[model samples]
Target chain A: MVAGRAGGEVMVRSPGRFTEISQDECLELMATTTVGWLAFVDAEGQQLLPVNFVLHGQDVYFRTMSGSAISSLADGHDDVAFAVDHHDDIYQKGWDVMARGTTARVDDPDLVAQVAAGARPRPWAPGERDVLIVLRPSVISGRRVRRQ
Target chain B: MVAGRAGGEVMVRSPGRFTEISQDECLELMATTTVGWLAFVDAEGQQLLPVNFVLHGQDVYFRTMSGSAISSLADGHDDVAFAVDHHDDIYQKGWDVMARGTTARVDDPDLVAQVAAGARPRPWAPGERDVLIVLRPSVISGRRVRRQ
Candidate 1:
């Protein structure tokens, strides 16, 4: 029983469907996901990295490579936490979203040309990413597991 | 231009390939990855969730559902952080791993029957997962981004 990816009919988690999403469906699923995970704390402590973001309305941008490790958090502790998710594991369904707040370093220049005229994460790694990192979220949460 | 996954024919970022992966190849790639992301600190500061783990030897197991939110961290503060990653966004290449100590609750039923005899995260979400979160790391790190 499969067939799902925005068209419907994929089952396996049909009990109590675990819903709890809103905040404009968690910023419209973090503006159409593009890889996420940026939970910081350096010097070898708590960490989770893997970024490639863009959501620029309520803030949540990304771009790194100043020696990556989240660009050394531009100098650490700017309160973090940013997560985006997706899971289908053969139809168990999925959706998860998280965003806490604080993390700046866009170094103004007309907001980096309005976030490079938006499109997507667009940094397939090469170098000179121009370190962007921006979070701004105060709080936004989500959850979902379905099967009607 | 591509073709990787341990066969060796992928190139893109050739400047010293950013290597630094050991600890037995980061526990053999976290024992064959099965979904990861768990970095904590609540009271609304930092958080990242997305579990489904299993890699017993050096510890790291997961299963939650007893009020969700990672079983409310089995009653808070046990020092967390866990991550597993991958990226090949058209051969930009990637690899990341992290784990930094503390987090327990395996309830000693012979260590949950020796972690239910290994292999796989096996929890597609439903309910009554009986909470079991163990991350005994003491700082394990990794990095990779090939083409050297």
Candidate 2:
């Protein structure tokens, strides 16, 4: 029984007869995804907000400004929340993964270029082309809800 | 020009007109919708995951367990991420919200009962009924990423 974090308990029993997934399975799930959301606290103390994101490998990435949520992180405050999930109303089944970690504005020119080079500018919003931020996971976990 | 997190000297300008949304506007956006994603970091320090979520008023609400992503937050961790966004896939216009805050499990009988009363447990892979988690955003902000 894994000790839970906040208000409840988490029970991850061994999947005996069930199809249990390996780390490879987890990686496989993240590969095809393109977008995600970042949870950041605003400078003023209100829950910052979730923003559309671009998924790249195990790294969650995005571009934003200093006046908003992205800025709060870049200003040297790295406490942040990042999440990714998929739910199909038609299929009625889905999976969710959440990450808590310190986010930093990538400064290394090589790393910045590498991430920026491969990234497809998120077509939805503006300012996606300028600054970039990455959330490195300190603790990552997931839950799958399925109905038979 | 707002400084980039990467120090790229990004302008951090709005997409103009419709792209600017305040924190209150974001709450309205969340209310207009039912499903969003919650992200948290687990024990493994991986970019954990995303789960489809339901926003309950000011706080973001979802059900989770010990081994799941929400479980980490329920464990009483301060770092948590919850987000909600919607976009037209073809039209490429919409808003995205990112929230970062500390997490706590709901023990409030009233809140728990309210969540149980209103939350219809849709199994993503089963086993959500046993756990309850809610994210109270400390900093809530969002962007309307509509093209001008």
True contacts kept of each: 0.21, 0.24
For candidate 2, give the lDDT of residue B112.
65
lDDT of 2 at A37: 55
**lDDT per residue as tens, model 2, B19-54:** 567888888887765566554445543233444355
Please write out the lDDT profile of model 1 over residues A1-148, one tens digit for every residue.
Answer: 1111222211112132568898888899888766778887776656777776778888887767677678777554577889887775566678888887778676665665566567343544344455666788888889886544
Looking at model 2 chain A, report the run of 10 residues with the lowest lDDT sum.
Answer: A10-19
| Every model: Cα RMSD to truth | 17.8, 7.0
lDDT tens digits by residue: candidate 2, A51-114: 5455556666666655654656765545566655565666555565665677777667666666
Docking tier of model 1: it is incorrect
- DockQ, 0 to 1 scale, candidate 1: 0.11
Each prediction's whole-model lDDT (CA): 0.68, 0.57
Once fitted onto the true fold, the runs of candidate 2 whose alpha carbons sit more than 4 angstroms away are: A1-31, A40-43, A46-48, A52-57, A75-79, A138-144, B1-82, B97-118, B121-125, B128-144
Q: What is the lDDT of residue B122 in candidate 2?
A: 37
Point to the candidate with the largest TM-score: 2
